[model samples]
Target chain A: MDNQRNERKNLRRQRRIELGTQKRSPLGWTILWLIMVVFTIWTMFPIFWAVITSFKHTGDAFNPTFIPWVQFKPTLQGWHFVFITAGERTLRSLKNSILIASCSSALVLLLGAFAGYSLGRFVFRGWKNKDIAVWILSNRMFPPVAVVIPYFLFMRTLRLLDNPLAIIMAHTVLNLPLGVWLMMDFFRDLPRDLEDAAFIDGCSHLGAFFRIALPLAAPGLVAVYVLSFIFSWNEFIFVLVLGFHKATTIPILIAGALTSKGLEFWKVASISLIGIIPVVILTTFVSKFLVRGLTFGALKE
Target chain B: MKYAYRKHVIKWFFLLPCLAYLIVMAIFPLTWSLRLSFTKWLATIMENPEWTGITNFRDILFKDPRFWSALWFTVRFVFLTVVIQLGIGLGLAHLLHNNFRGRNFFRVLFLIPMACPPIAVAFLWKMMLHPDIGIINTALQTIGLAKVKWTTSVVVAPFTIVMVDVWEWTPFMFLVLFAAFQALPVEIYDAAAVDGASNFQVFRKITFPLVAPIIVTIVLIRIIDAFKLFELIFGITSAGPANATEALSFYVYLTGIKWMNLGKGSAMSWIFLLIVLGISLILLSRLRKKI
Candidate 1:
């Protein structure tokens, strides 16, 4: 008992030193914090400049002012131009982005869940599960430009160009493979006993899946939801080509801020923030699940 | 629990939609593009696609100087961006994995760059890199340095793309690796230390080999996505300063869409697809073996 206690004490002490919480000089910490501070500034200064520039008057936008009241005055000119005065088209695009992203992600989850559950839980002849999963992932990996050109022509042929449906269909195709691959892992990780017990209780396979496995995998679903939504939301190429006029999204709106007079810094910054804020909220919501979800569980042990 | 083979009916019901949908959307389009690759037809001008077997492929491989230059540019861009991101990101992850004062605040700040879409990120950098009125140049000049022509200069234009990409993506690499590090068993490190292993030795022998799989996976993902670099070029440079930053994706877009050379664009994109597929396969197979 005495030897065991001493060994335990040594182990705890070793952990402390390894974590740099013990036996570290102030000089070392100062350098670490110094690196952190520099990294933070590199990460933030552009955004800090943008935040100030967004609120600055168009005339003051060129002045390189970091402070609002002292160095320069803040105005709503940028916000007003992007929202109030020329706001009609901008609002329409924001609505379009939200709708297209959500709708397509929902479609992806709907089809992907069933497919994922089937692939995970059941066996099919002539189609290996591993090969099927890899095929879906390979589709996801194909360059979007390859799809966009052909998709542009196809949408035009179908008279669906510039319709939100065209963009929605495109997003569903891009994200569904990812959804299936992610959801398959989640469903496969769930215990078979609960599902089997439900089946023994006269629950049909579909019933057991709907009542048991899905609730258990609800947390993972939220992860895939946010992942797909963000991909669909931030997408520009498909929207640039297929959703050209009626279905344009915020990224394109920000891009459109470039005019013959050059980009109005205030205008571009405001529009970009509009595009960024939703993703920030969504990512934070599912951040804990992200390591698994974002990497398709490639890092999962 | 011997469930009936009858459930195979339901199983196919669940799986067939995804397969059918992908076939129509992915397989069908790819097949069509493959067919288009052999023809000589500008969709905008030519009424019918004229069959010209192997001509488009031959011309693109041999005669197109811009194609070779664009390929060179893309390779360099992917190499520089991935290497730099991996280096800084791994270092940051190792440092930030430890708990410290105000760590949470810095963590939250780091997450912000990844939140912005690629186009908006390019714009944010463009505003900062503006030669005269931009904050970066203003700071430089105030400290007694010459300003850069960020958009117009050939050398600086491509560098700016790499810079913006590094800033935007390093957080992703850092976050993923940080989580991987956090998930590691700390006891092993303590044991290594007790055995008289130096810090560098511990990292080399234990930490790296353990996380080697994760590194390979993220690097493979980054490389594949980096080859698809499009939004930054479109938003910031439009391959300006005389095509200095024209990526393969941009070149494909220019040839296929903007210039309306459908046949050639199709061929170039097929080549692009094959190259990406080949790299991803090699990396992916290595990853499988590692894990």
Candidate 2:
């Protein structure tokens, strides 16, 4: 009985020691929480500044105080400039951005889905599967500088400068590769049994792809489309170089605000806030897919 | 059997549009640029390029200090910003890995900056860092510190650009590392814990080695992307204060578009392309070998 009590006492002391080491100091926990709070503040500060500055008048914009509503009354003049005075140009840019982003993304999706389905599902005679996919991705890996001059001269030769179609075509060059990489992984995940079953039931291969496989990959399709749209929407140099007055995207418009004499921070802020809202909202939905797509499907959750 | 043969023929049609588009847009331009880099036609002087046989490449390689300076600036920017971003991102990922209230909210908040428009980021930062009336300077003076010339001083401008890059892209590293942290094998960590490993010991021995591959992948991709830093510099300083922040891509833009030096610009671009391709090929080959 005495030996048993001694054994129990030793076990109790070991548990106490483990608890002592594992129990984190409250001060350390507080410091970590404080760091995360500071990080969040850092992340949100510029965005918050842009939003508030958009609501401020030209005078209030330079108030230098963090408080927006309390320092002075907020004005809608910046919004008025964006919506009414500069309305035509701003709306045209917005419409152009929407059109270009949507069209390029759609074209990329259609063409990429076809290629991705083929790559993921079939074995071509001459080309290896991995080589073809890597070649497609390598096209994306090339620096945009290599193509800008030639594209400019080529577009000039074709008389397609300042055309929305021209920018759409330019954007497709970037988005299509991304589309193929993304959809290849997505379609590859799907069970081959479904398509084989459909084929055995007398459906054509293409019909089976459309009727059986496409519907199953609908969510992936949406993810790819949204991601490509965000990319095209955020793309700057292509639209800047390829399109001028008629095909100016929102990024170009925001950039134009910077070059004008006596920079209007409030006006720039308003346009910028509007420009980012769509992309920011869209990205949150597909955050998981964004990481997957950006890493070229090498990393997945 | 006939239908199967026909199916094979139809399958080729699916890849044609994308392949053709890439050929016309990507391949043709690349070859054309390769040809252009060998010529000496200024856009304003001549209607057609005059084939001058490696003269453009020679000037860019040996004579042009501007090209070298811009390339150096790009390299330094990529190195500093990526290192800082990895450090911060890893820390944030570790801190948030713990289960806690409001963790998801913080993750969403952290990701907001990554999605903001680059142009907007530039303009907002430009206004916020304006020396005389900027909020940052105001706050500094309020605390009895001297004002900082954030983007104005030549010595500080490049670093300022790096700061913006870190702010904008650190979340990308965070999200990636966070995802990687989640996907780690739980059993190994549990076994390590049961083995009485200290937290640092567990991380150093088990976590770091496994996570190193993804870290390397992030570094490789970030280096490639950061080498093409144009929009931020274009919007923020426009490579201002005597071209202190002229990254190679922006240099190419100024040469080709602003100055209309298409021949030389094309030359610089090809040289830059070869460098990028070389580096990427090396990294990719190493990655393949490892896998």
Candidate 3:
């Protein structure tokens, strides 16, 4: 143990020496800081712009003011307008957005989790699993524009237009392929031993999956869940085409803010802020796992 | 009996609904569009659908200059956005790779743009990019430069879309590549260090080759998404300034929804579908080999 400790100490020292090349010069760090500062400013500018614009009065909104009080006084008018003036409509749309996004994402997640498990764990005789997964992923690439017109007509025919159910159904199709693809990769990456071990302990197949596999795949599930939710929350064309009056979402409302009289920047900014906030929160929380989810667990870091 | 039940019953039970839903929602519409493509069916006209076989496809393929231009513009948009996004994203990933304070915070911040709804992002940028009163031109004036027409000028309007697209999507490339960067084998770097490889050499020989696969996948994904560029166009330019920025999907939206020419729109969409399908096939095959 003493020798091992001494060897480790020596190895760490040697590592430090060799890692000297990895060290950036003072000039390098200054350049890095400059780049990072610029990048950060660039990344934050639009959000900052929106936040500030959202607070400004309609007259003050067009001006290039960077501050709340210094450049121009801020007001609650935009927020008030968002929550009160358009209160009934805004609140309804907000509720619709939440309900559609949550309900559809949950449905997609449940079906995806089950299908992903089967694809990840089970072998079928009739077709290749690879082919099925590839097919499912191919669906993710299907453009919404191609289907929107038909869905519009189809929903209108069924009197499903302006219904949350229609939007939910559309969003389910929009996100299911992604969810199943991500979850399949998740389940496939998981070791089979836990479930097998559960089985040996007399746990039923369903029990093993519920108690063991599901718990283990939680991180991947969370990643896909947030992703599906984000996509559904942000979906525009479906909500725009299929449901507008009764089932208006934040995107449709944002589009509505593009009034024929010309865009009222203050109003647009406020609504955009509402649309952005949930996704911002979701992305921040699940960002680490989201990278894996994006590539369908291809890079396992 | 138990084994068979678990295998067949469970597998089908798990799989069928996903496939079935996709069929109802995606395949059904797609096939309906395919049928619509071969006919002359204007949604505005109240008539039995006229089955005009191959005319829509032939016109879109051979006659319509607008279709060609939209496809061309979309192709340019995809190429430029994907390439620029990859370079900046990979650079950002590499720069952010080293341990630092507030690293995660910055990562999340960078990712915020990509997460913002594309329509909202476009609206925010549109407000900023206004030529006369927008903040972007406002900034240029403050910086002692002449104001530029960000959206109204025919020449610059298309690039305005590209710039906003890069702003909104470069984070996606950054996130995926940064994750790939994190997953790079440290031992190889250490070995390269021991062998006295230069930083450039290490990046070129080790890092580039290692993350090449991810770069491919992410770029392909970005290209696929970019091909469906409607929200940004719809929100910002609406294919304005002589239709210089009219993307394929936007053109399809115009053809199908705006004009109510369902047949021609559906045909154009099928062509668009084939192009995307081709790319996705390649992407999936590459992805299949990786996983």
In terms of TM-score, the best-performing candidate is 1
RMSD of 1: 3.2
lDDT-wise, the better of 2 and 3 is: 3
CA lDDT, candidate 1, residue A31: 85
lDDT of 3 by residue, A1-301 (tens): 9998786556544544576633768887788889888877888899999999889988898888888889999998889988998899999999999999999999988989988998999987767888888788778788899888889878987899999999999999888877887888889889999888887798877788789999999987787778888889998988877885899999888877868796688898999999999889998888776565555444554
Structural similarity to truth (TM-score) of each candidate: 0.94, 0.94, 0.94
Error of 3 at A109 (Å): 1.3
Count of clashes, each model: 0, 0, 0
Across residues A87-152, which tens digit of lDDT does each residue of candidate 2 receive?
Answer: 999999999999999999999899889988888877777776676777787777777866789989
lDDT of 3 by residue, B1-291 (tens): 786676688788879999998888888988998999999988788465689999999999999999999999999999999899989988878776643458677677877887788899989998899888899898899999999999999999999999999998887787777768766666787798879987678789998999887788778888888998999999999999899999999998888888989899899889999999998888989877754
lDDT score for residue B137 of model 3: 91
Which window of 10 residues has the lowest lDDT sum in candidate 1 chain A?
Answer: A292-301
Candidate 1 C-alpha lDDT tens digits along A1-301: 9998787657656676665556668887888889978988888887787788899887888876778889988898999988888899899999999999999999999989989998888876786777677777778778898767788888989999999999999999988977897788788889999988887799988898899999999977887788889889888888988977888998889888867696588988888888887887887776565445445445552
Q: In model 2, what are the clashing residue pairs, if there are any? A: none
Please write out the lDDT profile of model 1 over residues B153-186, one tens digit for every residue: 9999988899999998887788778767766776
Give the TM-score comparing model 2 with the true structure, all chains together: 0.94
Off by over 4 Å in 3: A1-22, A191-194, A197-204, A296-301, B99-101
Of the true interface contacts, each candidate retains a share of: 0.58, 0.51, 0.70
